[model samples]
Target: MKTGNKIKLFLVDDDAVFLKALQIQFMENDDFEVETFSTGELCIQNLNKKPDIVVLDYHLDGIVKNAINGMQTLDKIKETNAGIPVIMLSSQDKIEVAVSCMHHKAFDYVVKSETAFVRLQKVISNIFKYQKMEKELNWYMDRM
Candidate 1:
């Protein structure tokens, strides 16, 4: 969780082109190791892979065949691992949607756009920084 360390990232999106593009963009950074999933189910199935973070889209096609949306997938993920950081990616700009995501314990939400990748990198970096600090703080407290 140190800065510049290789952080495993699992990215879930229904858009094939966007998934591939993001995989490439994230992999270009030495600090990131990216895996792309075209569906939330696929990502969930591979949750044992222990990715440091998950980037998930807010919408998906064919998920649950008829019932589930990305938010439901997010809920499932949190159910399985509440501490894992999740960053929601969506084109939706409504404040309610963002607030709902936060209420559900998402680490952050980003509107999908040309600059989304850049913003994602920054967010991940901050996550790592915070995690590192938390570890240090816990160690200090344990020694007290």
Candidate 2:
């Protein structure tokens, strides 16, 4: 993954309006290529595209009564590709929920707010920055 390339991101949310807003926010930046999905199943199916990050809504109660939630989706994604970063989002700010998401290897748990998009952008940047640092360290170690 070259830093020169735009980061491909997958955002899964059942809320149509919120999903659209997230897509718009991420797409506005030239550094990101955003893909939106209404269900976690759909997003997981498309992981073959190898997105850099995933933004998943905690509750995926679409038309499907048995739809998988964000934590379940996070587990599925981690099982597929542990390297990909997944950030869980929800309106509920319960500590147990956040802790559960973290236990499932979620990169971050964000509660929905008016400034959620702004915070998301920062999280994305931090992930990329940390990845860059890790890659650089590995390169140096290989040379050693």
- Give the number of the best model, judged by lDDT: 2
Model 1 compared with the native: what TM-score? 0.90
In every candidate, how many clashes are there? 0, 0
At residue 69, candidate 2 shows an lDDT of 82
TM-score on alpha carbons, each prediction: 0.90, 0.93
The best candidate in terms of TM-score:
2
Which lDDT values do the candidates have, in the order given?
0.86, 0.91
lDDT of 2 by residue, 1-144 (tens): 337899999999999999998899878888888899998899999999999999999999875789898788899999999999999999998999999999999989889999999889888888878888998999999999
Kindly list the per-residue Cα lDDT of model 1 for residues 98-143, writing each as its tens digit: 9999998899999999999989988888888888888899999999
